[model samples]
Target: MRLTDLISPDAVFATLKASTKKQLLQELSDRAAKLSGLPAREIFDALLHRERLGSTGIGEGIAIPHGKLGKVKSIFGIFARLERPVDFEALDGAPVDLVFLLIAPESSGADHLKALACAARMLRDPGLVATIRATRDHDALYSLIAQRSKPYAA
Candidate 1:
């Protein structure tokens, strides 16, 4: 569940603008469509369905919106640093400025969970989170995640 395996430099956004969660999801959905070759509406629907279950926002100004798609052959990820924080209904009621969008195959139960956990672990580091916030270069942000990810970790 290494970050590098799921994300590339192009998938990283240095600064994204979205006034609301839905708008953000829509924008990401569009990008995911291009990257995954899936329909934007389909991806958006999947994310919205997952959100109906509960907000992916885990607090500390971060959110990880993810879902499984039947047509997906592999896991995909997109990371972004928002130009402005938006209300994400985070558990701690904090606005989300950093986000990671993950899409995986429907049958990838264990692999999907591992990837989600991997992203969570990476984002949970306060120092690293601070660094991600401070950095504005897209490639640098991707590198930070890639450098912090422990490939051997469970």
Candidate 2:
């Protein structure tokens, strides 16, 4: 499925205030919980559990933190562009400025991996990432993600 299908325009944060990996994950988890109708603490704990396994920072100013939760019915996503880069322990050792949080149902196995792959592919495009980073408003960022993610739609 497309990332836009899981992420609403309202859920996109154009100016995230977080400046550290921990804070960024907490903010994303809280947002995902509210959007998924689950408790923020529960979601936060799940994300933390996943992070303990390994850092999701994929480098090039991008990070994808994902979790599989029993409470969710389907995969959900939250995109955030931080106002300042945060030290995310990325593979390339660069700070992250863009974060895509993916939350999926515990039962979704292959689909969850596919979704994460799609997100990583999309964010890896230099042109697309540049456009998204240059976006000044929510609508523009949403539009960019929607257009870029169309090819992966189910």
Could you estimate the TM-score for every candidate? 0.97, 0.95
Model 1: per-residue Cα lDDT over 87-127, one tens digit each: 99999999999999999999988888888988898899999
Among these predictions, the greatest lDDT belongs to 1
* TM-score result, candidate 2: 0.95
Task: After superposing candidate 2 on the true structure, give the runs of residues whose Cα lies further than 4 Å from its correct spot.
Answer: none
Report how far residue 82 has shifted in candidate 1, in Å. 0.4
The superposed Cα distance between candidate 1 and the true structure at residue 4, in angstroms, equals 1.0
lDDT, model 2, position 10: 83
Residues 1-154 of candidate 2: C-alpha lDDT, one tens digit per residue: 5788889998899888996788888888778777778888878888888889988999999999988888898888999999999999888999999999988889988888888998899998999999888886988899888878854643
Candidate 2 all-Cα RMSD = 1.2
Report lDDT (Cα) of residue 78, candidate 2. Answer: 94
lDDT of residue 88 for candidate 2 = 91
